[model samples]
Target: MLHTNHAKHRMPVVTAVRLAAMYEDDRMLRSIRDLAPRPEEPLSVGEVIAQTPIGTKVPVTLFPTVGINRPGTDRWPVLIQGLEEIAHWVRTQAVPRLITGTEPPEPGLPMRYEISVGHEDERQAMSAGSTTSAGERHKKALAAASARGDLAEMISMIDGSPSEPQIARWLAQLNHEEVLERMSPLRMAFDYDPEVERHNFEVLKGCRDAALRFGDSDGPHEK
Candidate 1:
C-alpha cells in the first residue's frame, strides 16, 4: 500500500481558493468601505457626523454603491460640502431647535460639522502686526470704537489724549441706556475745571434719559 499524503497535498489548493475569495470580497468592499468615516483621530459617531473641513481634521467616508453594501471610498469634497450645507441649515432652520425647547431630530444623523480652521501663515502675519506699540495701540483704540460696549472706557484710557470728537464718537456708539446707568456723579467729579465740567455735564444729561430706560441695573458699563 502506497502511503499518500492526501491531507498535506490538498491544503495548498484549499488555502489558495480561500485567499482568492477573500481578495474578491475585499475588492467588492472597497466601494462602500471608502465611504466609511476615516477620522484622523478616533471620534464618537455623533462627532464624526458633525465634523466639517473648517473645524475638524477628520476625513469623510463615501459609499457610492447602490445596494451591494461594500466599503466606501474616502471623500473630502463631499464631506466639506455636507458640512457647509449643515451650517446653513443650522443658521436657518435649526435656530429654533437650539434656542426653543423643541426637540432636535434624531441623534447620529449624518449632519456635517462645520469648523473654522485658522491659517497659520495668516495668524503669524497678524501676530506680527498685533504688537502693542504706542502707534499700534492708538490705532487699536480708534478701531476699538465705542461699538465695543464696556471696553470703550479701557480704550479711552489707552488712548490717553483722545480728542473731544473721538470721545463723542465713542460715547455715541455706546448703548444710550448703559451710558446713563454707568455715568455716576463721581465720574462727573473727575473734572475740576468749570468749562470741562459744564461740557461733561451737558453730555451726561443728553444721555441720561436713555440710561434711565435701562432701569439702573447693575450690569456691564462702558469701561
Candidate 2:
C-alpha cells in the first residue's frame, strides 16, 4: 500500500534479469514454468511446495500456491518463484540486486482457503464490473450492520469476507476517515481485519470521494 518510485521500478528490472537468466537455457526454464500450476488448475499449497526445487532456500514468505482465474492471483506463483530464485542467486552469486516484473510479496500470514479464493474472485468481479458475488454482498451487509453498531452481525460477516482492501475501505467509511488517518501507522502494524480498521476505511473513502467528485465534472482547470 505504501508506494515508492523505487519499488515500482524494481519489478521490470527483476523480470528482465529473470528472463535473461532463463534465456541461456530455454528448456529448463520452460520446465520450471510448466511445473507451475495454471490459473484454472486447482493447485493446493502442498502441490506448489512439491514443485519447487528440492531444498530450495526462499528468502521471503510464500503464500499457499493457488490457481487463480483472476489476474493478480494468476501471477502469484510466477512472482513468488521469480523472487525466490533471484534471492537465492543473490546470496550465492553475490549479485547485489535483480530487477523483476513482479510486485513485492505481501507479508506472510495464516490465510483460510475460503478467504483467499473468495478474495481472488471478488477482485476479478470488481475489476471487470461484474455483479458482486454472494460473498461480497454478504460482506457489504455485514459492514452496514457493523456501522449501525451491531457487533454480532459484524462478527458473522467478518467470517465470510475475503481478506481484501475493498472490504476494509468500506468498513473504514462507517467510522469516518479523519480518525483513521491519524492512526494509519498503528493500523498497518497490528490490524488484520482491514474492514474493521478506522484508518483504512477513511483513506479509501477519501480516495473514492475525490475520484467521484472530480472524475466527471469538467472545469476550466481541467487538463
Candidate 3:
C-alpha cells in the first residue's frame, strides 16, 4: 500500500518536470532581436540561435547547433545581425527576386490599418497647436537673448544665419514697425508656415530693439 501511493506521487512529479522543460525550451526559442543586446560584448550564442527569418517577425528558433551560418548567402544559417543589416540584405535581394516574378512583401496589416484610420483634422489641430507653442517659446528666447545683448545668437538659433538680403528686408520691416506685413512676404518666400513666419519676424524685431538699446547707452530708449 505504501509503494502504490509512492508511484502516484512520482507520476505527478515526473509530469511537472516535463512541463518545466517544455517551458524552458519555448523561452529559449523566442526571438531576442528586439531585446537590447548585453553591453560590452558582441552577439551571444543564444541571440544567434534565437533570430527570426527575414521579412518576418516569426522566430526561426531551431538550428543545427553546429557550423557557421553566413547570413544572406546560399548556406546553412539560423540568424543574422541587426535589423539594418537584414534590411540591406533584403533590398539587395529584392530586385533579383522581382525579376524572377516574386511579389514584394507589403507592410503588415496593423500599420496599414492605422494609416487608413488616420484623422486628418486631429493631425492639423495638433500641428497648429505645436506651431503656436513654438512661436511663444521663440519670443521668450528672443527676449532673453536681447536682455543679454546676444540677439545674433538667438536669431541663428531660431532658424539659421539670415542672408544679407533677408537682413535688409527685416531691417526695413522693423523700421516700419510692420511685423504682420513682414510675416506675409517671409512666409511666401521661405515657404514657412504662417505661425513660423510670425515667430521669425518677432525675433527679428527683438534683435533690432536690442541693438538700438545697446547703441543708445545713455539710458533705455523710450518705448
The best candidate by TM-score is: 2
Count clashes in each candidate, considering only residues at least 3 apart in sequence or on different chains.
Answer: 20, 12, 0
> After superposition on all CA atoms, what RMSD does each candidate show versus the true structure?
27.6, 21.9, 24.0
TM-score of each: 0.18, 0.18, 0.17
Q: Tell me the tens digit of each residue's lDDT in model 1 across 148-202.
A: 4433343343323243334445466565444444453313343268876666556
How much lDDT does each candidate structure score?
0.38, 0.36, 0.37
Q: Where is model 2 poorest over a 10-residue stretch in terms of lDDT? A: 15-24
- lDDT-based ranking, best first? 1, 3, 2
Badly placed stretches (over 4 Å) of model 1 are 1-117, 120-128, 133-194, 213-223
Deviation in Å, model 3, residue 177 alpha carbon: 28
User: Which number leads on lDDT?
Assistant: 1
Which ten residues in a row are the worst by lDDT in model 1? Answer: 14-23
Q: Model 3: per-residue lDDT, tens digit, 1-223? A: 1123443346332110010011223344334353343222223444543344588565232212222223222332222222233444344454536655655443211111123355768644433332222334455555443433333444434443443333333344342224333333332323447787676677566655544544345343333
Candidate 1 has a TM-score of 0.18
